[model samples]
Target chain A: MTPASPAEPTNPPLTRRARRRNQLVAVTGLVLVWVLLWGSFTWANLIGGLLVAVVLLTVFPLPPVTFAGRIRPVPLARFWSRFLRDLVVASVQIAWLALRFGHTPRSAIIAVPLRVNTDLNLTLTAEALSLVPGSLILEADRRTGTLYVHVLGVRTLDEVQRFRRDVLDLEARIVAAIGSSEERRRVTGADPAGPPEPTRLEGTPT
Target chain B: MTLDAVLDIVAAGCLIAGALLSLAAGVALIRFPDLLSRMHAAAKPQVLGLLLVLLGCALRLRTGVDITTLVLVGVFQLATAPVAAHMVGRVAYPHDEIRRDLLLTDELAAHIDRIRADRTDRPEVSDAASAPGRG
Candidate 1:
């Protein structure tokens, strides 16, 4: 087990003022997500991503790892940009689906085996997948750390493969964004220096 | 576009959508035979539909304490809905059998005794059961 970060704050020590700010940040993120869904606007998406990042950083008090200090902000500028690009690409694909098929599109549950094992990263990946419109996280297995997503439309295996690729890419970006090196190591079963292997973890991309 | 007109359209849409979803929830609750099934119906559409209605109302009455109250109502519902369902499930646990078709594995069946003990200690039957008894 990785050691907890030295800088990680213990739960009981959260001060009232800090808690209040945290609550405020959480609420703001909620409002932003609500607005984004309501409007489906790109600007709102950017704002929501930043707001969520801030909430995760400030409000989500990471537990001390067995070895690593508290997980804090890693400079993931490239990761964020990549995620945004994926978001745009997925959004366009969803929009195309909406426009091309008015209502009677076939949908199926695709099993997506995740590369990341951390529960937090899994959840974030699920949430992000769901946000990509026309995809919903139907069920997740923490034991095997796989996710089943119901894709709005599916007609071919190639489409499924693409969906799997995009989702894994998204998960990788999220892991890079928020996870500690120890967490990554635990997930990939590799030393921090080694490349993440393509494990049995795969998703049924619709 | 007139802001008032835009707000009016949104408000109307919210109210309609909320009412429709709440109606669906009511139908589901009434149609489904068991407590868990009823809970399945009650949880999502009812909460979301009511929230939509509340949002619509809040949009219409955007200026004052009404919005705050709506927010409070939304929060209260968000917080309480799951808790109430949990309590109901716990109460109905022992006697409330599941349909074979619906359940894959009765995980809760293993801890039936513990659930019954908890209910016996509290014994606060929900109004749902009472209404059915009256009927």
Candidate 2:
């Protein structure tokens, strides 16, 4: 009950400097994409790619995902290493589940209310969770900053609870890697009120 | 053996592993009972499988331009696969497509009513305009 914040974090007001930086980031990424797509980086390619990036950005405005945090090399490296390992492990588990006979895999839908309810945090957490394991993003409630994850194969209530905890843990790791300093405290300090109690259910089905 | 020969051997192994994962995904598609499960099964393996296959391809090519193209494919797949899965999963839920009996617990059910209410309350915020009969 205490996990999610009472109010969602509104998008931070962007200064002119912030807006320019965001545009610069977008332009650089897009140009790199164009160059890579062309499979060469000659002067002609560089100039052409820049033109294309500008045109594309002008035509289709991008979403305002305020990146308020700086990348920490140590934590970023940790995130990548862990992500690659989980990708392999999850693939193996899913493969085994599919190949095995007789057992019908039990699934559950778990609502994981995030600790830091920023749009950036919510989006990254959802994306990472879907990739890492038996979890899939069913729906992400932006208003409440909750992610409803459909997890494959959980035979009991304990497993369900464990998965929820894992989700929170994953969210924390994500924040550590790239969340703002203020947001990082929310993870490090954790919920001030208390540990999250199990969400009340409509009826515990047998 | 030479370096090229050893690299070729590793590349072949990656290709084989990717193929096996893809096969597993196909098997799950048929064996899984419902739309949600099948969609989940069909999509997840293919992601890692595609990455492995691309890695093999990059190793075999061993050229800058080609490797960048392979990298692009991997990047795009990583970005888009989860989004595609999410789209399918949301539609599968609250419908006959989900084998409700097989679901151990549906935490979403508790919040479904309020979610629907919000959707109807602010149709602009939702994709309700895209619903077949309405728009």
Candidate 3:
């Protein structure tokens, strides 16, 4: 079997403006970490963090992580609210499953074909799924943008379809929030259509 | 009761719940059947538990300094945990650690096969087709 090629460029050169922005973002994050470690946000800590951040950025310049999408606040807000609600719901579901102890929860790994092909979209969707209690991404085929996710409590095919639809819904929300116009159109266009066809391999029964 | 007393009770509840969730995570890690399933146990509750504990600590401390640190801890944990779990899951799949019977579909295998055929059809592109992190 051939392995999946890495989607990310190893060291793609960044534009001058992009480089500056990357450095600024990194510095800001580092400075925040510094202040947190110091357990204060006084002038002294802020100044110290700033100096350290600048020095760190200058000394060790990292390859720029390119995001081909811009943030749309409305969609972003929608995503967050829905995510928060799902987090609570999933946690309660897991807690119930844990408490039930007697019944063996039937779990299955379902392959979901992703329409959103960008690295950022794929990564975000996987992270979101993994954060939720019931599902976790087992493997991602970068070649086809397919995610193999192990989901708890899927006994029937209908439940499997529902899980797949949930993933697609999340991807749509994410694309709407930060994806480019082309990505947004693709997602929107595919909405009326059914779920993307996923490649299936027969599993041998134990 | 007074506001401070009420806050203290809420914080205590958060801490207790967080601790219990973490305890449940440990149990699931051992009790789950296979590698991928166990990873769900390993990743989810642990993160939520940590977030709750951090929230409790932040509420109890209430100062600018302690709260900042707690916020940082929660943010970083939320950002990093899923990525780590993804990496673990990715590694487990190629190694056949996941139970085959438990998987309803194996799209990854199909994708790999397609890639292999495509590579075989064009020998010159083999170098480019060679996936990173695998021999």
Q: Which candidate has the highest DockQ of all?
A: 2
The best candidate in terms of TM-score: 2
Ranking by TM-score: 2, 3, 1
* Chain A of candidate 1 compared with the true chain A, TM-score: 0.51
TM-score of chain A of each: 0.51, 0.92, 0.82
- The most accurate candidate by lDDT is 2
Model 1 C-alpha lDDT per residue in residues A1-206, reported as the tens digit of each score: 11112122212233445445555555666665455444444666667766766666455433312122233455367665664454444434443433443343444445565665545565667655654534555455443455655454556546755766767667766665566675555444643543322222223111
**Per-residue lDDT of A189 in model 3:** 83
Query: List-wise, what DockQ does each model earn?
Result: 0.04, 0.40, 0.33
Candidate 3 deviant stretches above 4 angstroms: A1-14, A58-60, A191-194, A203-206, B112-135
- Tens digits of per-residue lDDT for model 2, A45-99: 9999899988887776555567788989999889889988888888787888888
How well is each residue in B10-111 modelled by candidate 1, as lDDT tens digits? 999999878876776676555554555455445455666777899999889876556756777776775566455445544554453433333322222333
Tens-place lDDT per residue, model 3, B62-134, is: 8988887788888888788877887787667666676666655555665545644654577543233322211
In angstroms, how far off is B38's CA in candidate 1?
A: 0.5
lDDT of 3 by residue, A13-45 (tens): 445676567678888899889988888668999
lDDT score, candidate 3, position A101: 69
